[model samples]
Target: SQQGEEDPQALSIQEGENATMNCSYKTSINNLQWYRQNSGRGLVHLILIRSNEREKHSGRLRVTLDTSKKSSSLLITASRAADTASYFCATDGLNYNQGGKLIFGQGTELSVKP
Candidate 1:
């Protein structure tokens, strides 16, 4: 599978702190996307940065892509208990002839203690 894998399967942090997670993918991709899920809820798109883009930000969230290594990193600032959730990284293949489906990584569970 050309899916990504996230590191630090679980993390614990205090409110107002920051959380960082890493992801590595198997193949080249046109773009990478980050998502967050609150428990049983569906995943919500947090940000999407194309291969041409090295970094992207959405509010307090920052994401960086490194195509050479087929990896990416996500940084979340000002943590809150409400921010506790599972974070996942996905990618759309680089080959134009390939299907456009997004492949998801095994997510990292974040716990923000208030």
Candidate 2:
């Protein structure tokens, strides 16, 4: 039950604005990762936050975790039109030993207009 479901199914924003997305899971997890997909392409890893850590940051992205609530959030600062894409959260979900196979959630689609 480590499946992580993202909230706010869709988001729209202008260039230079900040975008925030949230994810909630149903069980304890070893770690969680966020990914981005542009249009018809595959997902690309943005960040990974371990259960023992509360927050992490990479480039313009910030991620936070709350084990007590089994939830996490991703924040993108100063978004650009190129940032328009689908975002997803993934976890081990009992498949950790199967070549890193992961369980993904329904994603949040973000649109950034220039």
Candidate 3:
């Protein structure tokens, strides 16, 4: 069974706007990560918030975790047409012995219209 599931499923915004996506998961996790994929290609790691960490940021991207709610959110500021892609949240599952394995959510497709 999938451990994580993305909410909304899709998002659309114009350049300079902010894009937000969310994810919810079941079971305890060592960490939660956000990733982006362009043109159906491989995913690019964005940011990760450890189970003990509440938030993290990278460049124009921000990630927040609320373990109490088993949920996480990703915010992308200054949206660009290039940012149009599929955003997914992933979890490492309940442990670390999994050898860096990741279980991904259904993904939220974001379109940054020019």
Candidate 4:
């Protein structure tokens, strides 16, 4: 599958701490998007980084992509209990034969305790 695979399938952190997750994919991609999902809820888009861009940020979130290594990382700073959620990475590319649809990673489950 061309889907990305997230490392450290689960993570736990205290409030005010930082959390990081990693993802790796097998094929070339045009863009990668990160999404967050609360339990029993739909995903919310976090950020997107194009293949040409090395990094991007949104509020307390930071994302870095390395096309050469086919990997990406998401960092959340000063995390709160509200930030507890599952994070997913999705990619779009020639190998993603979903008719321009995205291929998603397994996802990383994050838990933040106050």
**Top TM-score: which candidate number?**
3
lDDT of 3 at 100: 88
List ranges where model 2 is wrong by over 4 Å.
Answer: 94-99
For all predicted structures, in order, the TM-scores are 0.94, 0.92, 0.95, 0.94
Give the per-residue lDDT digits (tens) of candidate 1, residues 13-105: 999999999999988788999999999999999999999999998999999999999999999999989999999999998777766889999
Q: How accurate is candidate 4 locally (lDDT)?
A: 0.94
Best-first order by TM-score: 3, 1, 4, 2
* Candidate 3 vs. true structure, TM-score: 0.95
Clashes of each: 0, 0, 0, 0
Model 4 alpha-carbon miss at residue 76, Å: 0.3
Report the error of model 2 at residue 22, Å.
0.4
Better of 3 and 4 by TM-score: 3
Candidate 3: give its CA RMSD in angstroms.
1.0
State candidate 4's TM-score: 0.94
Write the number of the candidate with greater TM-score, choosing between 2 and 4. Answer: 4
Error of 2 at 43 (Å): 1.1
Clashing pairs in 2: none
Candidate 4: the clashing residue pairs are none
Report per-prediction Cα RMSD to one decimal. Answer: 1.2, 1.8, 1.0, 1.7
